[model samples]
Target: MSNSLTVGVVQQPAWPDKARSLAASEAGIRAAVSQGAQLVLLQELHATHYFCQYEDPALFDLAEPLDGPTGQRLAELAKELNIVLVGSLFEKRAAGLYHNTAVVYDRAKGRVGQYRKMHIPDDPAFYEKFYFTPGDADDERGQGFTPIDTSVGRLGVLVCWDQWYPEAARLMALSGAELLLYPTAIGWDPNDDDAEKARQKDAWTIIQRSHGVANGLPVLVANRVGFEPDHSGVGGGIAFWGGSFVCGPQGEMLAHAGEETQQLVVNIDMARSENTRRIWPYLRDRRIDAYGDLTRRYRD
Candidate 1:
């Protein structure tokens, strides 16, 4: 594999209409390709609005099977552009079974692999637990946290809420993942004060960057932008602060985007992960024998 990898992120606002939302994603993908990005990532649920803000049974209709229209389009785009692409979807696995899933496509190989969002969030405005069944512990081919193999590299794909967990990132790194990628849609309540909003955004950024520093791998995050109103009227709408970014092996920012629809393209030095790990060998010095309590629900 090449020592350098050019990656891109599409931070775009979504719409209720799938066609319009997909158009925006396609435009961003094309722009990224024009800039010579070999791999591209789209924000979570780029096909529709943040409907998880409120739970309604009728909204289940939004879910589609694994080979749904959205997935097919993403595969076609990967083939057309000859680039590795990552996209998110609402997957309808079976009757009343659904998940927040991320799919990967590699050039002409079509759909290569996928990862289901493991950590489902149920906060006030984010009610993912109601709409999604937590991903199974093991996919047919491998374990839940297994990295997906692609032409670009081994991508440790995780979804929105999964980004917050250190164990998830560590497991991916342990499984020999070359990079960590997050398809996220996290935002703040518009009513929050400026200070609170800043804190929330900063915390989100820091934790994800820390994942890179801890694992000695590059990190790529694609977050949605714009204000999405809570049509259910249960609370104020979420203003998605689209600070999508890419960071290198040592937690250095390569490229970042503000709160707007933007495409970020950056070159990641793939060899840096190996070099950094040589100097700061966190993985080599891990106390694997004494960490049996990690599987417990609580120490108490």
Candidate 2:
């Protein structure tokens, strides 16, 4: 059997309306499946606009059960396309309990698993704390760093703010993940200069790529694009820099996207990770016995 998988990332702007956004995403998923993608990824909160820009109790209405309309729609799509799909959603775990969750669906397995975003951001424009509670260490199924085993491969799925933490990536790698997938909703402030935006984008790209290099696994990020204003009319809003991308195990970028609407599909070798890990040996060289400080909040 060929040890390669063709993956696709959907990078599109979200609409205020849920139905419209789902329709657009369905079209994008079909586009990718048509082009021979076995596994597809969608941007974070793909069902609606990036609403974390402001604190609003009304926005909580956007949350839904995993098997809700959005989940059912995606499941139907994956079953129809006969492909593995990784997507994100605003999860309504229970009444008054919400989470930023990444859900994975397989063609044969229905709903494989989900990863609640461990790190929730609460910056100026990104008011996530007011909206989302921090993710538990384990999912409802009681698993952390558990890669979903599918027809495509083992996917180490994660979410936006979780992308910045290397520990999360490493744990996934240690759990036998072949690829790291991050459904992201990241952007820049409208007031920031062009230089700052560029720098932020570059940092976002590099740090994740370094995860691939450090763990000997491929990394994929699907980010939303376009400008979304604060619905409460409190902040200037965010311009989500849609630069979705994929990279190889050796930190070599296989595909990259610009700051616009795009549907990126890239083919990658799944077997290369084993070869690279054998040569680099970072996993073997880990001094697991000496690193006890990582569990602490800070060294100081």
Candidate 3:
């Protein structure tokens, strides 16, 4: 595999309509491809605004099957652009069973792999647990940190909340993922103080960056920007801090997007992970035999 690949992260506002949102995303993906992005990653729930703000049964209708229209559309796009595409969607498996899933389309081989969001968060505005079922424990369908093999490399792709857990990152690395990619939709409550917002966003970015350093791989986080309204139609809802960035193996920022704008492309040398790991060698010195405590829910 080549050590360098150009990737693009699309950070744009979502429209209320699904068709319009899909069109906008397609346009963004095409534009990224035009700029020479071999792999394109979109923000979480890119086809719609963060609709988990409420627990209405009506919202469940938004969920579509993996082979449904949405996925098919993206597959067509992948074939058209001849670029690998990573997309997140609200998937409807069966009646009353839904999941927050990410699909990776390999341009060379077509639809190849997918990973469901494992860690569901039930925060005030982000009521994900009520909607998505946690991924099944069995690895039959390539769940968990099993990286998807593509033309570029094995991609350790995970959703927003999963990025917070070190176990997820470790498992992906153990499975031989060359890079970690997070398709995220995170932000701060409008009512929070600016200082608090800054702290929260900074902490979020730093945690993911640390994942790169700890596992000796690059980390890419694609977050949504702009504000969406709350369920109660109140004032401004979560203002998605759009600091989508790419961090090198040593936790150095390779590329970053602004807080309130749409960034098209960010290029990086994928081979940097190998050189950084050769110098730092954290993976070479792991004490695996002493990590039994990690399996326990809590060490009393």
Candidate 4:
């Protein structure tokens, strides 16, 4: 594997229309490729507005098979651009079955692999548990921490909430992932206090950076920006704080987006991971034999 790779993260406001969203994403990918980005990542569920704000059976129509139109389009895009593309989608596996999945396409190898989000959060405005089935033993065979082999290297791709779990990062590293990529859609309740919002965003960034340092690999996060209305006509909606960023193996920020509006194309040296791991030796020093409690729900 080479030491360096140029990556691009798209941060833009989403609209309720799917057609417009696809067009915008396509344009963004083209622009990134033109700028020499070998790998491009998009926000979570980028094909439509954040739809989990409310639980309605009608919204289930939005889900489609992984090999459906959206996947086909992205596959074509990867081929046309000749670049690896990472995209997240609301997948329709079967009738009344769905999942929040991320697909990775290696331009050279074609549709390389995929990962279904393991953690399903069910917060007030975020009703994801209603739409997605938690990824378990069934999905892990074809979709798990197993990295996607690409011309660039093995890619450790995880969805939004999965970023908070150290186990997920560790598994990916053990599976030979050269870098960690997160496709996220996170923000604040519009009614949240300014101080709370600042704290929340900081905590989010810090946790992911910690993953980079702990696993001895670079971390790339792509998040959506702008505000989307609550379909339930709730008092307020989500204001996506677009602080997408790329961090080095040692948790140093290589590039960051602004809270309001920002898009970045950053170059990362994949070789730094080896050097950082040599110095920190977190992985080499881990006592895997003493972590039996991790399997139990609680140690009590």
Give Cα-based local distance difference scores for all models.
Answer: 0.94, 0.89, 0.86, 0.87
Runs with alpha carbons beyond 4 Å of true place in candidate 1? none
Q: What is candidate 1's lDDT per residue for 265-290, written digit by digit as tens?
A: 99988999999999999998999999
The TM-score leader among the candidates is 1
Span of 10 residues, lowest total lDDT, candidate 1: 134-143
Per-residue error for 99 in candidate 4, Å, reads: 0.6
What CA RMSD would you report for each candidate? Answer: 0.8, 1.3, 1.4, 1.4
Query: Model 4 TM-score?
Result: 0.96
Poorest stretch of ten by lDDT in candidate 3 = 259-268
Per-residue accuracy of model 2 over 64-164 as CA lDDT, tens digit each: 99999899989988898899998888999999999988889999678888888888898988889988877778665735667777778888998888899
Better of 3 and 4 by lDDT: 4
For model 4, residues 91-162, the per-residue Cα lDDT tens digits are 998898899999988885667888889888999888999999976543546666677778788899899989
For model 4, the superposed segments whose C-alpha errors exceed 4 Å read 138-141
Pull out the clashing pairs in model 2: none
The alpha-carbon lDDT assigned to residue 78 of candidate 4 equals: 94
Best by lDDT, which number? 1
- In angstroms, how far off is 133's CA in candidate 4? 0.8
Error of 3 at 42 (Å): 0.5
RMSD of 2: 1.3
Ranking by TM-score: 1, 2, 4, 3
